[model samples]
Target: MIDTRWWQRGIFYQVYPRSFQDTDGDGIGDLDGIRRRLDYLAGLGVDAIWVSPIYPSPMADFGYDVADYCGIHPMFGDLEAFDRLVADVHARGLKLVLDFVPNHTSDQHLWFRESRASRDNPKRDWYIWRDPAPDGGPPNNWISNFGGPAWTLDAASGQYYYHAFLKEQPDLNWRNPEVRAAMHDVLRFWMARGVDGFRVDVIWHLMKDADFRDNPPNPGYRPEEGDIGRFLQTHSADQPEVHDIIAELRRVVDEFPDRVLIGEIYLPIDRLVAYYGEDLAGAHLPFNFQLIYASWNAESLAALIEEYEGSLPRGGWPNWVLGNHDRPRIASRVGHDRARAAAVLLLTLRGTPTMYYGDEIGMENVPISPEDVHDPWEKNEPGLGLGRDPERTPMQWDASPNAGFTAGRPWLPVAANFAHCNVAAMLDDPFSILALYRRLIALRRVHPALQTGSYRPVTAHGDVLAYQRELGGESLFVVLNLGGETQRGIALPDGVAEGHVLLSTRLDREEKVTSGFSLRAHEGLVIALSAAT
Candidate 1:
């Protein structure tokens, strides 16, 4: 058995705080609201909660833009409220991880305020600033993730400053030793105040090449919205310098025993593993995003799983996430009919799985009208279906009165379909998605094979996905029917024992029931085997 701490093996639920719950009825979710919902998470069987940023900000990029690293946003609560939240969550045996935005800071941050004061300000080197082009434009043609030129020319200082994201969130120049020390100190301050670790924000963007050369255009034709998707390469951004900084950050985390450090890396598999470092002196879990890419095909998923398992660093743990505040939720991605099977795939995987808020109830993306759209992405890429507001809507707790999330209006409107999809309604229905989630979590606890097992793929074809998870001297095989009708006689590897149906959610039975098994639409099973039996 793995004797690791709870942080190593426990399931984490990511909460987009602004949309989770609202206690004060000010159209915004707050820490107090999350405090009231602690029992619900405890019941859901999650070990920790990773709350999105709640620091003071102008709300340009929601809470991702931080005006103050140390102060709580008054909209969320005060220091006492935050303290109460920590105490309450710990009382529930749950750890809390705050979002750490080390890559950049809100343009209004005090350091930025002082740095932008004059050309020769003492803190001027804290942020990336450069002279304008000969034509007196931005430093280069490089674009922000949001849109337009990454460098914004500041008339006051007669220089162009860098921002990989929104202009309001300026990139910090990590080349300055003082800036690196300050970011590290910000992390230490949170650790002192009882934060478990950090979900390091935009970790790769913390460092950039000194030469402000223009990024080459894509060879393939594309709309100007997403990245240069012509090739899969992420050449300019994922620099090797990131490893040294991660080494330093890991040292800080080691100071506090059992503290967790998860990096939000959007790089490919090979590049992602480097965050763990050769000596394993890096982040605890580089967040896995394969589930997002392989949402449609079982064959692709099986191949990706094999590749990911083979790519892990020794002594390093694996983490899987199906959805987050940034991306569209899984239910929405895979369509409603396939989400249940996706749930089985998620819970039975051998790594720690993270459930995005509201996913348990199978929440669909709430479509946004142009008039009500708040995300800058949609604003920049209108009609491109690129806005994030759909997935960031308020949580649905009940059927009436703003879905029992807020007494007042919500920051983003809940889906009209919440009348059927909600906690109160699902709590009574055994077959509801929320109940299924609860059962899956409980089953994981009941069988150690589901948690600490080694995954081996079961060979199958055409809409039938099968795999075995083996550990603790036992193996549990799982199969899912992705098609609408029943599927029969799928195949497993050699040494297959006659299988007894452990659990099946299908409404159909196979005719032959050969070395493989049969499953109806969305039906999934966990069957175990032992050499002694």
Candidate 2:
């Protein structure tokens, strides 16, 4: 079978819809806002746009706690607007990947409402509900990911409901065949509407321990790590049955042509790759988030990449991510100078690269004041700096009022440097971070080596990570200087006597190398090596 799936080689750009753009002066981004910016996304060269959840919800955990799986949120737009957005995305030859919230539903969802109505209700089994322990307290020691107890008492029903993150976001009982079919049907609803695929949210948390055992304590956890780390989550997440459910989802997605299923799994590399399933029957792209958590050092990162690459199931492709809605912006994590080099590292690596929206313009995390804070996690757990609000701020399109995101107030404040560090400003500057990203993406599209080639780690000394991507006798060497000091006499492999710089993170420097190359502080370059003589 020829593997020509679009997601396999193409790049992904994730947009947090509520902060993307506002079209109706409603102070919130809508589907039309995204529609208006489709051209911008195309110009950026992303193969698809994975918009965060825009479904009807009570705003408990933003759109993750979905109220209706098939309906668009009124705040975002109606079905008509969504149809137009889908049309526009397709019109530009781009794919649309919706955020599929399968693990939980809003308390306001009809299913949840029916389930919590009464113990004898027909829909009572739709969600995870349990009777209290003999002492009349909560069911178990499982704690909510946000904070406090995971079980919530329902006075009206005389039972307690389980939630992974927020009480208002109840976990669905995937052990029930009915719930699995229902969620699969939801995928059908979107696929029928022309959505190319789905990035399933919190996919590993779909099934829990059938016995409802208490999660064992995590001995490595510290007070500063927040309540979630207090337990190993042995009974609450990554259950064995989740693979069956993921395979079912894969079967549903396979029913449609050229569609992809991406699972948002945060397990160790060994366990994370299991989502690929035997014979490649599971998620087409089990999102690799190791880069997001690994130490930003060359030695450690090189080892991490090797481990991930070494773990893939036969015929399984690789993917990479630098940042996301839940994590701090890349610039904030690695600093501005290193972010440019990081871009080269991300795009030049051997996999599908998922870029966060504001990353192209090098947007950092915006500071959110307590008065303006709105993330439910932060609200649930005070003063832990656990809230995602800082990273979910509005995208800075231009240097206009509200950073050109909206005419009215934005849902969150734009990053402080938006005036000069934005698309408009970067478009005109050849050396800007956005230019580097665009250049790297364009380069990747033209070069088969960087697209789906084999990756081989190259040896280089301290603070420098080197690798080569090769296909059909053509090779691209990526050398990154993760440190601040210039490195001299970096040796090229034998038979690779000469090559010219294809693209450099430094932007100003380009050269033809003979035997060796020197890297400046925090610099990276992609060199096209001459075929071995």
Candidate 3:
């Protein structure tokens, strides 16, 4: 048997620090607040915690524009507070993964500041800087992910610097050997501080075309798709050279034993899988986000899973994500009932699963008014509905003022449904979404078939999707009804006559099942199948 690492078999919970818990009553969460919640996370059965950026920043992109890679932001905490948090997390036996934004740096960063100070500055080559086009416009036709041109004109230096996201985030020049060495040292600095892993931010955007070619216009782009989709991004992102850079990053991570490298690549599955590098020397997991964007019907999801599984390179591991800080909550995307069913799908999948901060309680996207909007994406491109503030609201912890996320007002407004849709409220209700997630995770813990077994598709028809996980003769069958109509006499694989119900999304009806069983609307089940007889 192959030796499985801790990341391979463990569940990862993403903690968005600013909205998780606030200790100083400043309407923002901090490191000590996360330390206080370690017990809660341990009780939730997650084996790892992946915290979003808490690094020193100008808040231009809300931590994505990192000003200092090695220091913690004062708003979050100092190095001492971070050390204490790391200690507490390790004490609870949970691995800590930090977000590593290698693609860009805050314009205020010393490197960028010097690079923009003058054309002759020593660090002028640290970031991508190019002369203006013949027409004195942007250097190329590349579009920023946030909005507008990807290049920002620096009047002082008489050059334009490139940024994939916000203008305040200047893209690093990975082609420079010094820049690559400096970034690798950043990883070593954190690994020495005991960070178990890194979820590399936009790993695909690390390198760009050397000639700075203009990307082709996206003919199929629609107005609702927002400004970033206007171009095909053929030259600006997903360059072939990125794999070599990733392999180098992988070497840095491999220096520290048992540390995993997860890449954030938003390309198609075929392109996304390439991040694994030759012989799986790239990212350990490239963050499978198909569930977040795929249609929620059984047929589409079934095909997606099969395609994703088949697309993996030899020995490459798979992972799944349902929601995250940048996407809508599962409950809001698929409705509350189907969200419960989705939880079962996530935990029972063949690889590591990442649960967003408030997803366990079936949190929906909160409405963010213009006055309360904090996300730069929304502020920069108003009324296009591209803002992520709705999905990045404070965690609903209790029924108290501010939902117990903070004593002061939250940075983003708490969801109005938090009064009844909180951890405290759902913990007592066995049928609640929180309870369903807990049961699913607990079921994964005791069943190796559910944790590291092979995934075989049984059938996906109408509203019912069925599959089986088997390892060492232990077979666990999962059936999910993705619609509002009840499914009757769902077909099972040949010779599978009866099985005992191990868990259900509705938290009801446990008994031996045979050929004829009625599945409730928006329900899912995990069954321990009997031997073929």
lDDT for each residue of candidate 1 in 21-128, tens digit (9 for 90 to 100): 998989999999999899999999988999999999998998888999998999999888999999999898999999999888899999899989998999999998
Q: Go through the candidates in order and give the clash count of each.
A: 0, 0, 0
Clashing pairs in 1: none
lDDT of 3 by residue, 129-243 (tens): 9999999999899999998899989997788999999999999999999999999999999999999999999999999999999999899999877889998989999999999
Instruction: Write the candidate numbers in order of decreasing TM-score.
Output: 3, 2, 1
Candidate 3 residue spans exceeding 4 A from truth: none
| TM values, all candidates | 0.95, 0.98, 0.99
Report RMSD for candidate 1.
2.3
Candidate with best lDDT: 3
For candidate 3, the 10 contiguous residues with the lowest summed lDDT are: 489-498
For residue 52, give model 3's deviation from the true position in Å: 0.6
Backbone clash pairs for candidate 2 read none
lDDT of 2 at 120: 85
lDDT (Cα, tens digit) per residue for candidate 2, span 118-204: 888888999999999999999999999898999999998789999998998999999889998998899999999999999999999
Q: Model 1: number of clashes?
A: 0
